[model samples]
Target chain A: MNDLVENVVKGDIRAVARLIRDIDDGIPGVREALKALYPHTGKAYVLGITGSPGVGKSTLVDQMVSHLRRKEKTVGVLAVDPTSPFSGGAILGDRVRMQRHSLDEGVFIRSMATRGHFGGLTQSTRSAIDVLDAMGKDYIIVETVGVGQDEVDVVKSAHTTVIVVIPGMGDDIQAIKAGILEVGDIFVINKADREGSDKTLSDLRLMIDMDQKKYEDGGWKPPIVKAQAVFDKGVEEVLEEVEKHRAYLLETQGEIDFRRSPKRVREELMDLVKNRVIEEVLGKLTETGDFDAAVEAIARGEKDPYSACDELVLPRLEIH
Target chain B: MTGKRRIRIMVAKPGLDGHDRGARIIARAYRDAGYEVVYTGLHQTPEEIVEAAIQEDVDMIGLSSLAGAHNYLFPRTVELLKEKGADDIVVCGGGIIPDEDIPTLKAAGIREIFTPGTPLDVIVKWVADNVEPRGEY
Candidate 1:
């Protein structure tokens, strides 16, 4: 077990892969490994790619990885797909498009299933990113499962979130109403060869113009790049934009700890606390049969849910 | 975090065969059986398949080939896994393999071969009975 931590820190691929699997499986004692790995993280730049299904996210990621490799950067990719809600199973096919890099020693590509997690990513996805970071990857690209109007969780963990959209399919309305649109560090019009490309481009431009005025105090404006990922065109421009965004964040933030900014750290800490409290408290309640009893009381109208919740929780609180 | 561990399998098509209908159906079958399936699209070499399997840390690799290249592709996949010290990953073959080739393939470390008309449930059940999730966790 100790050797697993050491080998992961030493960048052994097999060990790294094993640790990631263990993390995904919720194997016992992984917390210690994560604790050992915590300090080694924050070195890799995390880039998030998210969009609707069949928008060419995987292909674009494949191209971007190749371009980054050409610049001599080691890359780790985590591509997520949805799980079957009924069967508790998943078909993780995102790695299929990125198989070209499977044999590259400097590139590690992993496919993840949402596995009942909402917001386009799973809890294990975050831990897997840390594993890749500790394994010495210079850049980590997290590809969320094809998301919809919301599911903006990617922005919390990514330094640069690139939202990909195709030329048509009424995405203009989607962009207008989506919480996802607000989180893009960059927007991509992939499949730009199709018709209505000009219309889509104009719509996005108008929307950005309207939105940028609010942040016009020397803030970064998200650039829109036209791309045909399958033909390998405009990928270099996308990479260039990613680099520019990185430089912009570092310059504007006035620190090298953009990945560990105060806001992000606070969120991470709170999330850890929330998950632990839920696990411990809920486990105890369920084990003691109090949880079922409370549920039965609520179902029978003997106790309101709010009062039952407080009754169950207030005693457990350490009121200092 | 408290969920049961699920079996992960990679269904890969090695060699130049693009007839992936069999692979696709089997992948869906595995998914419906409540297993996580990573379907590596078409035209993957043995090296690519093995590397992907190890990276994914999957318990099994179901190789599909209709181009009559299973004789070389299946064993080569097993060999590469062995060379990478990942032979603990079970390797199974499907698609158009003849009865005569079964003994040689199994001798070469291919665990089981399911030829045409073999039911998907049988294959899934074989996997459930034969393979456990790999690693100490």
Candidate 2:
């Protein structure tokens, strides 16, 4: 499976997509791929790009990828989409936004959905990142779903987070409610040509200045830059600034993604525990072969879920 | 996309789309009609949606994009969803779709197209009518 996924990591898009599916299904093949790729992880400079919907995040990411490629840096993008609550299906289309990067041999673009992982990247995301890292991608960008607070939770895994905003609409309190301002390492005022760009930019800068440093090491003070991404104006400067920040982090090593250590450990442990428990429970469920009976009882109100849990699950755990 | 219990939907914004008034209203409609809702903030792309759906085992996808790239983004997403072996999953589109473009979308095999200002109840019933749940509520 790792061999298959290794091929995937090395420009085999079809194999890669299959590997992603395997990961989604929690299949054995994905487990092999992940275990094999773990050692090759952590090379890429993880970047988190987030903003309001109309702020042109996709367009900006396109520009950034283009600029990075010009610098000969290999890249991978994890774009998140929204799924309907009524149906757990999603259309992963973030790749369509990066027309140029999609064709680049040095780039890997994977669109992911929240799949309602409780506001975090899926277990497969970490594996996918590992594959991309082993394939030598210098930058890995995770574009999280804009599910308010969960957005922050997802991006916290990245080394640097860029929170993008645009002018106009709503009150100052609303801006704060978005929860982006606090998480941003860099603030982008996209659509700078629009009305009130100056005001938005100024207000953001002031807010940053007013907020106290939460980190003792005087973590990076976010710099706000105004640009219109639609016309490609000011994109170059944004890229340069992004580069500057990347270099700064590299030179300073200001933080080792202070968040990754705990996130990784917790996730690995939980995934292990979850698999063991589910395997035990399912083994019991299947051994009894009372699938139809259980269903009928649950459906007929002969057994509520609470009692079913006690009868079916608790006893299984007790024996284990 | 088949489930016995109602499929829970999560409308996420993967980036900085601050205008989620539409996504939220739609979520409310789905919830009132007996569905679980997982609303990801704003500015989400296709990947986030897929990841959430796989985890939630959703039966359908609904995204609102008035941002002009719907033609490019939406169809590409549908293709990717198919690649995921979720071809049976109904993919729907909404938000500012032009009258003329509706047919093109239908031709693309989108489950249904619901434009802006459509009734929330209609959208709820439409989803219920189109997709089957796999879980027991």
Q: By TM-score, who's the top model here?
A: 1
lDDT of 2 by residue, A186-269 (tens): 877888887988888778877787665543465667788787776777777776676777777766764544324666568556
Model 1 per-residue lDDT at A186: 91
Among all windows of 10 consecutive residues in model 2 chain A, the one with the lowest summed lDDT is A115-124
Candidate 1 Cα lDDT to native: 0.86
Q: What are the per-residue Cα lDDT tens digits for candidate 2 across B1-137?
A: 11123355545433334576787778677766666554545666676566545434456677777666667666766776777666666778778779888887777777687898898888988887787743211
Model 1 per-residue lDDT tens digits across residues A247-305: 98889887545545898778767666766777667767888999999999999999999
TM-score of chain B of each: 0.96, 0.84
Model 2's alpha-carbon lDDT is: 0.66
DockQ of 2: 0.05
